[model samples]
Target: MPLTDAKARNAKPKNNQFKLFDTDGLFLLVSPAGGKWWRFKYRLGGKEKLISLGTYPEVSLAQARARRDEARGQVADGIDPSQARKALKAARVQNESTFEVVAREWHTKFTPTWTPGHAVTIKSRLEFNVFPWIGERPVNEIKAPELLMVLRRIESRGAFETAHRIRSICGQVFRYAVATGRAERDPAADLRGALPPVKPKHHSAITDPEKVAGLLRAIDSYQGSLVTKCALRLAPYLFVRPGELRQMEWAQINLEAGEWNIPAEKMKTRQPHLVPLAHQTLEILRELHPLTGTGKYVFPNPRTSKRPMSNNAVLAALRRMGFEKEEMTGHGFRAMART
Candidate 1:
């Protein structure tokens, strides 16, 4: 006889396991240990076969019957329900392994070898440019044209350089996916010369000694944030990268030793660098020490002492002193020193 909800729930376990038959080959298997399991029994290819539906209380009487009817329908159509279930599970797993997932995994794995600033830049680029477009697509299924469309979107904004960078980053991600068995091949590899080449840009510098002197005179006369003013003063003296200069920490400087020790993590070459302080540089440092000596950075942000000054602080100071971008820039100090 077919089982009902009351019969299934109230049924007690016997000394041995037994089955309570329900309609359409569905039944409740009450074990000797008081465990109630729902199962389906059916015939296929003129032989009997059985499959598990679920457990009691979890898969109640009506739900078990529904599942049984579904499985029986599969048999009528000559499709084995077991194989279909496996295929569905595999599809779900593949869908969950997306481009964003694999790319982020690759990033996390290699971030330890990269500088903090470089790592942050790469992550920000991927999140802002790549993820929103193709992140959800399965890594294995992404095609070359699809990736080109993503790069073309970046190019549409006149950011030719940034577009090329995004393409390179995507190529790295696709290569990682291939090595890790998530993708068959890198679609980014097929996009060779797909974007315009970025022109090499040089920082504009005033190499003439007379103009250099004029720039120095202008910096001395300028009145701005004291931190910015000090940074501007040190730019000509140190001629370090603007980033390296701005991020200088109090701990890295020694007034008595007349030296600044920059760590490897902050350097572009990933090597420790030492900058010997000149007498003029020492004097500037001493004069500014009273105001920011207790802070972490030599040039702390004017609004927040916890952070370094803006990367553009020196550039903005030059602009305020009437220097055009083509005439001079924060990075121009390096070139000016070489000349």
Candidate 2:
């Protein structure tokens, strides 16, 4: 029978591999591989045509019968199933662009236009966070809610700023995809006003000049590592971000000139900064010279000179001094000096 409606239960398996029947002038074969397939044999425009329907039991006998009827109707209308499947496949290939492939293509095209450091920043964030999440999803199919889910994960970790930056990069990739006709619209668009606005957590700032005098006075008495002491002294005088401060290389500083040159690669504003060192700042550097003078970084990790110290080194030093994160961070010195 072309349509077998029997249900199997506690029964022995059939060894017969070929189960065949005819429906609507089409021969249907159910192979031992469990493939319930359709084949149409006819002269199409004076050429013989053979078409496969699909696999079974997924395509049951009843479904195959319906498809067989549909194919006969298509043949009557002078349409070919094989040719139609080819067109459908081509359309799917055109519409579907994997996130990683499109992202890298966009990155390759746009990185040339960005400043070197900014380009690295964009790439690092994507590789570590974004790629692992949506890299396999089709670019056109990524919804704003899905994007929100990714950003919210970062936000939950208290990385509010990083969440914002990643959101920006995702937006950039989508824009590139749109320009190249890989995607229809930038789902990350209008997300600027859509995502949560970043608010730097309120920290305990030293507002009183007297308190600043006391904090500086207390800093002088701390018996910490020379690297940390120097880091503390320089934090107030140089007032660079923690990353810039930690990544400070010997190649960028000139102790003789009483100047520290922050490289373009390390700065938040994407430009090198020049700090005219106070005598006190120079003294701290001079004291630490014998310890780290041969290394790549002035404050390299105690365990490695090729790599910078962990970002938390200075902050951890502060915590040991009974200062909580909200009270005074290494970067808080900048906020304090400004006030």
Candidate 3:
């Protein structure tokens, strides 16, 4: 059926469905739910296939027919229409201007001068904090207030440190946008005093000595699991951050050598760290081996069965031991050890 304007209007929905066929290798498929769509059914690589021609009357029959001919030409050229369409879609996505694009470009330009940790920190801040807010908006179109809104959100959570970091990230992104001619100037420059400062007490440590002694005793007293006992006993002996402790790979620890070599990438410094396994640390490792030595990570999370132990897994054990947050933290052992 050659669908003219009159035919289109005359086409009726039956039981909430309609069909048009026998033109431009297309059958207009109408959903029982009230959406009229065009589909071209054809043979490709000896397999019958269907390609959507979008919806009509927004996509008129004439437009559907035009698209059918284009797809046919692609088939003649030995290119699958689906793949061709996918390639075209990808090209269009690449061509579209977006905030992610500008931010990445900004990241590329500035990351070379930054330490690896700084680069990672900046990227993480942008991905979580800034990109969601204005990464999709045109850099030139972003207002000061809009940028402030992003930082204020971080401030609201009392993550003032992260908020300041986002401010720096925004400044870098906007500068990159300006250099690349995507934006006019950095709107983040004048917003220094816009957010609350991070408090001084959040130095990422456990504060009380008496509580820590109690927590240590609880770890020693823990009889629920040998792995937990080893981890708790060795906590202070290998006073690396909790993350460094948990990400301990089997290959990284040498029981005979009495050392756990934390690779730089895993360490906060991104430099290889030598954990001098005191006799106490090695003794705990020996016991931990019978339980988890068969796995790659020294302490794989029992619940996940794949990843390193949960970051809070050890901390949670402390919680179960009835330790208060201020009394002891996973990092508090470091403070106690360092002091």
Across 1-339, the per-residue lDDT of candidate 1 in tens digits comes to 778899899999999999999988888899999999988888888888888999999988888888998998999999887777889988887876798998899999988767887889999999999999999999999999999999999999998898888888999999998898888898988988888888989999998999999999999988997888888999999989999999999899999999999998888877899999999999999989999999999999988999999877888889999999999999999999789
Q: Which regions of candidate 2 deviate over 4 angstroms? A: 1-96, 107-167, 191-199, 202-204, 268-270, 304-306
Candidate 1 whole-model C-alpha lDDT, 0 to 1: 0.90
The TM-score ranking, best first, is 1, 2, 3
Which residue pairs show backbone clashes in model 2?
36-56
* Candidate 3 regions with alpha-carbon error over 4 angstroms: 1-99, 106-146, 149-162, 175-189, 200-208, 303-305
Candidate 3 C-alpha lDDT tens digits along 97-197: 46677888778876655557778878888898878877777667788898888888888887888888778877877787788776788899989788776
Per-candidate clashes, comma-separated: 0, 1, 4
TM-scores of the models, in the given order? 0.68, 0.58, 0.56
Supply the TM-score for candidate 3.
0.56
TM for candidate 2 is: 0.58
Highest lDDT scorer: 1
Q: List the lowest-lDDT window of 10 residues for candidate 2.
A: 4-13
Q: For each candidate, what is the lDDT?
A: 0.90, 0.75, 0.76
